[model samples]
Target: MGGIDREKVKGSFHRQAKTYDQYARVQKRVVANLLDQVRKEVGTPGRILDVGCGTGKLLAELHRLHPEAQLFGADLALGMCITAGAHLAAGAFVTADAESLPFIDGAFNLVTSTSTYQWLPALDHAFAEARRVLAPGGIFLFALFGERTLFELKDAHYQALKREGEVEDITHRFFPPSRVEAALAGAGFDQWRVESTLEVELHADVPALLKSLKKIGAGNASPRASAGLYGRKRMLAMMDIYQEKYGTTDGIPATYEVIYGAGRCP
Candidate 1:
């Protein structure tokens, strides 16, 4: 695969603007954890920039914590920007890409994101942008899905395809902690630390899980992904495989490997 189709990804989030927060349970948890970590590692930020600030959720929390600080949000999707701007009267929202921010060097004292970077195929440019936009001693706090995230779903789909005499790998790949560390080092971000945590969400079944992902604008936007993933036969096969392999009496579990990291500008 060349890389994630950014336009498609933008469209995905744009289409889900109305329902994003309703279905973003995992995202809410991740950002809450991100905020807690931010409070622990950094002092009062003068100017904060939130990358991929979908619907201003993180910005809202930051505003709640630091009412005196300035807030700004950036998202590639115009719909998301508009949605975020609607409720956040205190912050400025802009349509911009994470790989190439429109801000000046050292424009922000704190940069934050959550449940965003996993969509990018590579991290060099995005990480560099985060580092570039941070002032000296500023901190970058972020949480992204790690490689182990959604393993059961990937495994089930692979087995479903294999049983049907097909061979393909269409699921989107998430970066591991090592790659994240490497990207931060490459970006010249100093005093960095990264950790992985497992967070599991229980869904009614495969279809429900798929719907949750779609509603949250987390659909697989990989160029190599095909319609076969949702085919009736393949989907049903996947459901059975998933239930038999990873299900519990409570419900079917969807595992998310959340990788949280923080770095300071030297």
Candidate 2:
């Protein structure tokens, strides 16, 4: 995509609200790991906001862990907001963007997100918003798909397009760790910690992996994708190349580079 179509992202998530958790095995793990990290490093907060809280999974888990703490969830997709509202009936839910939250300054002591920031075109504004909404000593913790995410599939796609005499690099790319750090510094976080880990999910085949992506609302929103440039002939070619290169006895590996970042507000 030239730049992510925010509306498309919202629409895709809205459509997948009900089925998201079913196909979000990797996301669940990311949330669990992020929460576990917080429990070890940040402790419990008096008030918390989970940005892009899809279906309220992370917020529900947070409620279970810290029943006394205030919980708030925000998402751009209306369907996601509705679903989250049901699960967090006693808490608060809002349809909002990460870069422009509706909450007042210092409304929360902790802000958390997982598998959400990757969809954002840039992190600086969102990080600033997070800082703007946090109290002193509050923490901004998140896990996002790093630059290396989906490398194998992107490589295969590139190869297929090259073989078909196409030159545009249509594969979407993610931000690197340096960019995240820069954003945190620009947002004037008091201090920061950032790290990365590689996680892989196995699919029976390339087609199976593509289907799983769609089911999880991770479908490509590229202009090329809309133009049907990612067409049948190229798709078959990509599948063949992916199998030959990355397929194994167990399955084809789809790798995600998860970058976890934590910043403390002044």
Q: What's the lDDT of the predicted structure labeled candidate 1?
A: 0.90
lDDT tens readout by residue for model 2, 1-266: 24676777888999998888888888999999988977887777989899999899898888888898999998989999898887777568889999999999999988999999888888989999999999999999999999898899999988998997887886567889999889889998999988999999999999888878887788765534574336789889999999999999999999999999999987
Position 212, candidate 1: lDDT: 94
- State candidate 2's TM-score: 0.96
The best candidate in terms of TM-score: 1
Worst 10 residues of 1 by lDDT: 224-233
The local distance difference test score of model 2 is: 0.87
**Clash-forming residue pairs, model 1:** none
lDDT of 1 by residue, 1-266 (tens): 23687877899999999899998888899988998897888789999999999999999999999999999999988999999999899999999999999999999999999888888879899999999999999999999999888899999988998998888676778998999989988889879889999999999887889899889888787886665476787889989999999888888988899999888999
Model 2 residue 251 lDDT score:
96
Q: On a 0 to 100 scale, what is the lDDT of residue 41 in model 2? A: 72
Q: After superposition, how far is residue 158 of candidate 1 from its true place, in Å?
A: 0.4
RMSD for each model, in Å, please? 1.3, 1.5
